[model samples]
Target: MPSNKAELAVRIAAAQPGDSVRGLFFKTVFSLIQQHAGPAALESVRVDALATNYSDLRTYPVQDFLTLMYRAADVLEATVGPENAVFHACGETGVTRYATGPGMLIFGIISRGDPQKLFAGAQMGYSAAVSYGSREYLSTGPKSGTLRVRRDMLPPAYHEGILTGALKVLGLKGTARAHAHDIDRVDYDIEWG
Candidate 1:
């Protein structure tokens, strides 16, 4: 999995040189900040920790990306409200548009957000499709499934919003409930009928 991730990062770097692992996310994030917190506040954001150039397509330490994201979450929570605002903030701004071309076409053919197929894609190292630190398929029923997304390092609010937005994009009516087993992991019960 790590190899696959590294390969993808390499491809991304090659495709868009002078960009960070954050890639398109950098512009979108700043745009969101500007909208939610005003341009002045956006300017105050120290994005340097993530990378010297937000537009630079260079491989950066994953921890730096995480720190920048958590800080963005703080900004959104304070400016946009705490209830998954970061997710909604990004979702409403068309973050999933990043999944362009064949990648999304396949997902669209799968009837949008089918957990089973999505999981398969993630297992195949298609993190852009559906990502988690380390996920385990716990229980899958005819109409629902449970995904144990370990590495609760990132806030659930972040995932919850992204999950909801992704499902919605696929035209799937679903609800996700996140259970924090420990600070290190979370169990998400995603239900659809």
Candidate 2:
């Protein structure tokens, strides 16, 4: 039999990237958890909301992604628990904005045991091929972007926060400094357990 963490890792790793925006988001979240939390921690944690932007492509329209995300949230609420679940959507504008093309997908899973805790969160974006500023439209514009997303899931913010907080709760500390890239942003702080 696989260890608890290993089992969790398998469950997460087994998730396939569906043919929609949210599929990638779930895959990214699962991958990140596998990378950072290891098998044991994963087994200990329970995922509350597995929100996705797209649920059905055939019957559901593309613009209705937000609605579908809400539906997914409902599913999570019903499957997991109602009190601790959250579902969010972002478009090409405002705080939830992304690049011009296909926009991005953001989803998060709360910790069942600790409502305030976050097990994992993820954001993914895809840009279609397009032309820009007198330049010839390249067939390959922006493909996709993936990363672990969390609101205060880490140090300087612990269990009371999100995924990083859950990591802290599990005793995963940051030894390196913070850094930002044009494509991504990462923050790190020391941890002790």
Candidate 3:
């Protein structure tokens, strides 16, 4: 997991030319930690954003990724604003914008007015969460789907925010309502205008 995460981090960083954009994610997370949780908490989290300052890709523990997600989400909620949703949009938009190779194919498919492709991309994108797998029902209705993920992993509203924001960025109107049926998976009923 550590090695795979390192490779992915490097791959995402390579979406842009410079190293500064490479670590912008961890850098933003660390800054939020320092501002809200203070230096001690920041130190406890223990991911040095400065490592991304160079043109090299750094490998961080997989736990760091998980921790950052929760902490960053917490910071977003505690800070009070719509800024946290921006995190999702920023990452997705970055990937959509600077994407090359196979990503170009993805963007192309998405450009031809297919909302199902968007959900497919979201399904695959969220799959990056360690070994998590999402089950998406894309053939249900017109530009509508059901995305199911672990209930305990992320707040349902976070997923809703990401869906709405990302779809808006992609020039579609998206709305999500979450339903938790059991202790395992939560279903996000997604519809777009």
Best by lDDT: 1
Candidate 1 lDDT tens digits, 141-164: 876677777643444555565556
Top of the candidates by TM-score: 1
Per-residue alpha-carbon lDDT of model 3 for 31-90, expressed as tens digits? 656776578666655555433332113334333443455545444444433433534533
Give the C-alpha lDDT of model 3.
0.50
State how far residue 140 of model 3 sits from its true place (Å): 3.0
Report the C-alpha lDDT of model 2 over 15-48, residue by residue, as the tens digit: 3333123333333333333444455433333233
TM-score of each: 0.67, 0.22, 0.54
- Model 1 — TM-score against the truth? 0.67
Q: What is the C-alpha RMSD of each candidate to the true structure, in Å?
A: 8.6, 18.0, 9.5
What stretches of model 3 exceed 4 Å from their correct place? Answer: 1-62, 81-105, 127-131, 150-152, 182-184
Candidate 1 lDDT at 187 equals: 77
Candidate 2 vs candidate 3: which has greater TM-score?
Answer: 3
Q: Please say which candidate is ahead in lDDT: 1 or 2.
A: 1
